[model samples]
Target: MNRVVRAAATVILLAILVPLLVLSSAAVGPAPRHWSGVSLSGWELPLVDARPRQEPGTVRAPHLDAVTDRLIARGDGGWQAVVPLHDGSVYVETTRLDPSLFAELGRDFGGDRVSVVYAPLAPQVSPDGGGGVPAQTLWQRTDPLVTWATLMFGFPWQLGAALLLTAVAYVVAARARRRRAAGTAAVPAG
Candidate 1:
């Protein structure tokens, strides 16, 4: 078989195997879990309870527990919960963020409530907690496949890439050394 053909076949085989291995490894370990998105508007925020009875409601910054009161800034970046309170409703609004949390807001629910959007809350806060929770907030469900793929293939891919680079470097170095030795041998010995 030609060298190119062998290399191509190997690459194709690994490409298929890599994901399979990652998924298998992930399945064996405890899965990484992600929560749904939180609804917030300036000073007000809303949340959904996933227990049997289901607890949902809108909470404001001043009214929420300082320790558990957390919220995400809207404009850029991601959905980050800065601080989680011991037990209470807290909300935070952001302008610039690092990681995106839009999908999170769309997933993770326990009961009748699949998820809650800004059902009542507009960009601005309202006297009735429109921009926040409605005192009947309910969280939704998350995609387990995505959660697994993130941890499984993500770290493995990083490590695999690093190993591949190191292997290439060794090959190049060996070829260089061989060429240098051949050139030296071609010259007359001093």
Candidate 2:
């Protein structure tokens, strides 16, 4: 009803809304294009140099070895090497054949013979009913309700600071109004 209350409400609302809007906007950026008809069996490993490839030292994929075994056993006419990228995505290198082990798969190193499949190392339920695999997009990977819950209730320090700022603003405005009223009251009822 008073200016102080209005100002306090505005401050609190802005404090809450600004961060929410920013995070939501970031999360809502253009939806990633999903590859249709893609299955773990169909994905192939890309060709790299003869140097030994390394998985990321941190964040190992729990099911990666199993998936690799399946891929190798399937003999799906593609070479598959699972290499972890710097950004946490696993690049499964797929080629038609092993260059050294099985020379029959074709050794043409012109880059056209290799295909790279990208997915996060985190396990996720398959959206296409093929089986569980790492999710390809933020929308598919994260539970919406859980994310909202964390955003609303998590980060106590940030919430506390915003509340403190709101209270301070309210107190300052109220004190100023009171001082003005007291000054006017002393002025001979003018």
Best by TM-score: 2
lDDT (10s digit) by residue, model 2, range 65-85 = 644555555443232256544
Worst 10 residues of 1 by lDDT: 109-118
Using lDDT as the measure, the top candidate is: 2
TM-score of each: 0.25, 0.34
lDDT of 2 at 149: 39
CA displacement after TM-score superposition, residue 71 of candidate 1 (Å): 13
- For candidate 2, the TM-score is 0.34
CA lDDT, candidate 1, residue 129: 38
> lDDT tens string, model 1, 1-190?
6768856865655555544443333334321121223322222134532111113443333433322222322332112233222233332332221113423333322212221211222133323334553332222122334423432344444337545755686599779989999999999977
Q: Rate the local accuracy (lDDT) of all candidates.
A: 0.35, 0.40
What value does the lDDT take at residue 127 in candidate 1? 33
